[model samples]
Target: MEMRSLDRSTLGPENGFSQLLKPWPALNSPFKGAWCVVAPGTSTTRHAHPDYEIFIAMTGEATLSSEGEEITFRQGDIVHFPPHTDHQVINDGAEEFQMYAVWWDQETAGRFLERHDGQDGDRDGQEG
Candidate 1:
């Protein structure tokens, strides 16, 4: 077993967003977790990735835009997006918007998406 501390985590600031405690570029893992801070009145550019991603708001609020829809997410709300799904988060609040963001490889992500998508097939060919 291993233990880590959030206070010792690293901060990466880029393109109007800052990611704290990313496991990569230092540690190795199929999944990575980060505490993302979006500065007030700032926004992230529309982008897509090959990994499944999720964001859970921990403080303040933000507006998420994707697929022609915009939704406001408050503290304690969660958002999930599949691979290659273009999305952007805008911090339009008066305070910094903080959230927990997680990403994993496509294979691991496939399981979650498949289950929710009502797919009956599994990697072992078992029926759900």
Candidate 2:
């Protein structure tokens, strides 16, 4: 088994986050993991990708904006985002908001989309 640690010191200023695990052929990982810490009054870029993702809140509270909807989540809350869904996290609280993010490979996401087609309405997986 491969073991990795969460090292905040490695977090880059450009992303305010650090990648923990990723699809490495040698490691045989099919998913990616990241540890993110959003400073107060800051927010992550509103973006989307062709990969299924889930975010687990570790501390503080934040507002998750996705698909034109805003949802509030606190510590221990988990949120899932389907592939191609635009999302952004805003740390409106005084303390920093920490979250662990995991996303599956694009191939896996494609298969999931095919299986769930039209179940949640048409999702062309394209940005508007």
Candidate 3:
């Protein structure tokens, strides 16, 4: 049983957001977890993992786009993404968006979503 507090000082910005990854090199955990901080007007790329992903809002609000559907969620709300489904989250609010995220089957999930967004950018739930 390993236990530790979230150290915000260790969080780093990446892909338009600041995140605290919990899976350390020697942790040997089957899942990957993170505390994500999405800056206002920023959005995460439309991406998918081979395993299930979960997100719990910790602060602010954002619009989540899964497949072609969109919904707004705020602090305290929980969101779940089915395996291998594409999704994107955008923070349109004036304040920074924050969430606690967890991905099951870290190995498979990492292999599947290794690539970041391409030229298309964040999926806008639009059909071309």
Show where candidate 2 strays beyond 4 Å: 13-16, 23-26, 106-128
lDDT for each of the candidates? Answer: 0.75, 0.78, 0.74
Candidate 2 local lDDT, 57-107, one digit each (tens): 999999999999999978999999988999989888899898999889678
Per-residue error for 12 in candidate 2, Å, reads 2.2
Name the candidate that leads on lDDT.
2
Candidate 3 lDDT score at position 98: 84
TM-score of 2: 0.72
Candidate ranking under TM-score, highest first, comes to 2, 3, 1
TM-score of each: 0.68, 0.72, 0.69
Better of 1 and 2 by lDDT: 2
What's the residue-level lDDT of 89 in candidate 2? 91
- Count of backbone clashes, every candidate in sequence: 0, 0, 0
Maximum-TM-score candidate: 2
For candidate 1, the C-alpha RMSD (Å) to the true structure equals: 8.0
- Candidate 1 CA-lDDT value: 0.75
Candidate 2 Cα deviation (angstroms), residue 110 = 11
